[model samples]
Target: MAKSRFRSTTEHTMDSKGRLNFPSRFREVLNQYDSEILMVAPWGKNHLRAFPLPEWEILEDRLMTEGREKPDLANFIRYVVGGVAECSLDKQGRVQLPVQLRTKVSLAKNIMLVGMIRHVEIWDKEIWQQDNEATSENFDSFNEQLSQMGIF
Candidate 1:
């Protein structure tokens, strides 16, 4: 299959009502998918992860493969699936994040949308700053380790 292309990083504001106006370029990416449904889940400390319906389904399918034998895998499937919600961009190219997700991520007004290969991560501005700093500090060591594995 062909790889998906993602939009670059964008900084956006979430309205007081928990509505986020997604970048127009990102909306265009979603338009290419069949359902126009975006799936979201918590990502680590204070961030949300967004994936297109197709990509989410692929992940779900892989997770389900271990359902027969692994109890832990079954629990993970349930947790991730239970957290999934369908999202659509409004006419104004905005998406209203469910309140639970918004609060889980500690998202307020300023937010960062970071492009991952198969998904986008929504992060609180402050958390993103700290995460970026740590990643920068470790970049050289991380790259060297990956290169040792012939991954770079």
Candidate 2:
């Protein structure tokens, strides 16, 4: 499988009113495509997830693959469905995060946008700092363990 070329990362701040000024580089990535996008507050995390419309469709398809008889899948879909919102960039190249998402991520002043292969994760500054620290501390050991699995 081909790896996605959309990986990018940026740190930014959200204003007191919960509006974020997305980085220009990140905006450039979005501009390369013509499509609406969906931003969602993923479960069990204090962050927002942004997915291009096409990518979101793929995710939805994957979710649907879970058997209808599975209660966990149903519950997962309910939470994900309610947390997702369609968004678009304004002239200033900013997207207004929904109030719930902003609150979910505790996004007030400092924010970080971390690009994964197919999506972006929005995190609060303090939380990102702590998470980064934890990841850094365990990265070497994590990689070693993964290597043992022959999956690294």
Candidate 3:
């Protein structure tokens, strides 16, 4: 069986048609989950996240159940699910990121495919460099806080 969580990073290019080669390891994980379709959406201002359809459905269901009683949760649902693009891998395991999404995140030809446990995130090389620097600076504080939650 494939691992339950994805973890790794690799660089790939977006074609002129806005299509990208999904990492082969990620594809194997998707196959284990029995899905070729994914929901791709903006994550923050720097990256796009791809969620396997099956995985996304589970998250959507949870949000639906929880959002009914929380107004902010509902808004989050709209922000994420509302803008999601449903994409399917072609015969060659290529998935097309929407043009608008590419523009919104400033994704260029050179990109990075990052397996971030629950989802895979795509990032522009330059943007990833910037974001990584910021995240690294916060790691110590984050680790300290996370330890209190039994995450250490």
Candidate 4:
């Protein structure tokens, strides 16, 4: 059986308490895992990535085993692994974004939850807009790259 993947995007506002509704579509995908928790962590300077517990474990295992002696990999493990937060979905279908994680990613009121196949990305709305625009402008080049990679 094929693994369920996240898809599409949704715009939402983080409440004053730092809680945002987890998109139902994303929840549907998560449901297949039989897990209620997400391993939320910083994806970059401006966004966060959330993985289901099982997926996070797979990644964590690889990070621990494959690059234990590499300095660059150690730094990555420090930043990404150290910053992970286990966020549980509340009954209201909202997940509380930890303050430190939010600050690390520069997230605030306006947010964008983007489906990234294996994981979900939570982006600051403004940053996502600028990045999306740049990607749109460079689509032809990106399309060629994708085609070269046999994606199309």
Candidate 5:
């Protein structure tokens, strides 16, 4: 497994043609995995997430395994896997966000690419701010859960 963790946020603009410049470092990680293919999927109605093909496969495996006996997981897995678009970047370090996905997440021309360890999350600036507004207030509550999980 690659030990490097993606840990930065960058703001970028989408060209008129609908292509956005992917960060060089992020692209390099995809290359290291031997694939540039990304499984783009919407989470909820506000944001979209991306996982390089190999990384996505690992997540798929875990979801599927848990889904075998858990109907809820199966249904969610169905939704996630069903609503994905396989994407690849062009030579210019730009990727065309599929219209369907763009609409799903309300992706505007100006957005932020956030690194979430294993995957990438593309967020509409307004939504990102909205979603995080309560994070600071809820940190202790959230931290308690993380501690229970042995994550902190």
Candidate 6:
């Protein structure tokens, strides 16, 4: 049986057509959602987040309802929710990433698909390397915070 959540990271290459061979392990997680559609959107400064259709709807609904009163949150919704691209995997397990979306994050030849629990993150290979290194640098502080929260 497939696992309930997405985890781990996998390297991938985008074809000239901008299609990526979606990882098989992540596809197993998608099966649990019973949906072929993925809502891909810009995340943070340098990555894209892909959510299953159902999950995307849930998030969209929340953004619509909760972002009404908060200016900062509304801005966030504008960036993340407004740029979503609906995508589906082809028979060969490749998904066609929109040119605009790909360009936004500078995704070119090499990329990384990162399992982010409920969603998956797509990052440029070089950017991910730099970001991962920066995160690793602060691991001790993060670990201490997690421990303080009773998570470690």
Candidate with maximal TM-score: 4
Clashing pairs in 1: none
Return whichever of 1 and 6 wins on TM-score: 6
**What TM-score does prediction 3 earn?**
0.91
Query: Top lDDT: which candidate number?
Result: 4
Residue clash pairs of candidate 4: none
What tens-digit string does per-residue lDDT give for candidate 6 at 1-152? Answer: 54588899999999999999888888888888898888999987799999988889898888778767677897788888778899999998888999989999999899999999999999999999999999999888788789999999
Please provide, for model 1 over 75-105, each residue's C-alpha lDDT reduced to its tens digit, 9 standing for 90 to 100.
Answer: 5666567877788777788888999888877
Candidate 2's error at 3, in angstroms? 9.2
RMSD after CA superposition, every candidate: 2.1, 2.8, 1.7, 1.3, 1.9, 1.7
- Over 4 Å off, model 5: 146-152
**1-152 per-residue lDDT for model 4 (tens digits):** 87779999999999999999999888988999999899999876989999999999999988878877666888788889999999999999999999999999899899999999989999999999999999899888877778899996
Error of 3 at 57 (Å): 0.5
Model 4: residue 36 alpha-carbon error in angstroms: 0.8
- Poorest lDDT segment (10 consecutive residues) of candidate 2: 35-44
TM-score of 5: 0.89
**Backbone clashes, each candidate:** 0, 0, 0, 0, 0, 0
Model 2 Cα lDDT, one tens digit per residue, 1-152? 34333566687867665556666666666655556454555654677788877778888877777646576777678777677888876777677787877876677677888888677888888898898899899787788778899979
Ranking by lDDT: 4, 6, 3, 5, 1, 2
All candidates: TM-score: 0.87, 0.82, 0.91, 0.94, 0.89, 0.93
lDDT of each: 0.81, 0.72, 0.88, 0.92, 0.83, 0.90
For model 2, what is the C-alpha lDDT against the true structure? Answer: 0.72
Off by over 4 Å in 6: 1-3
What C-alpha lDDT does candidate 1 achieve relative to the native structure? 0.81
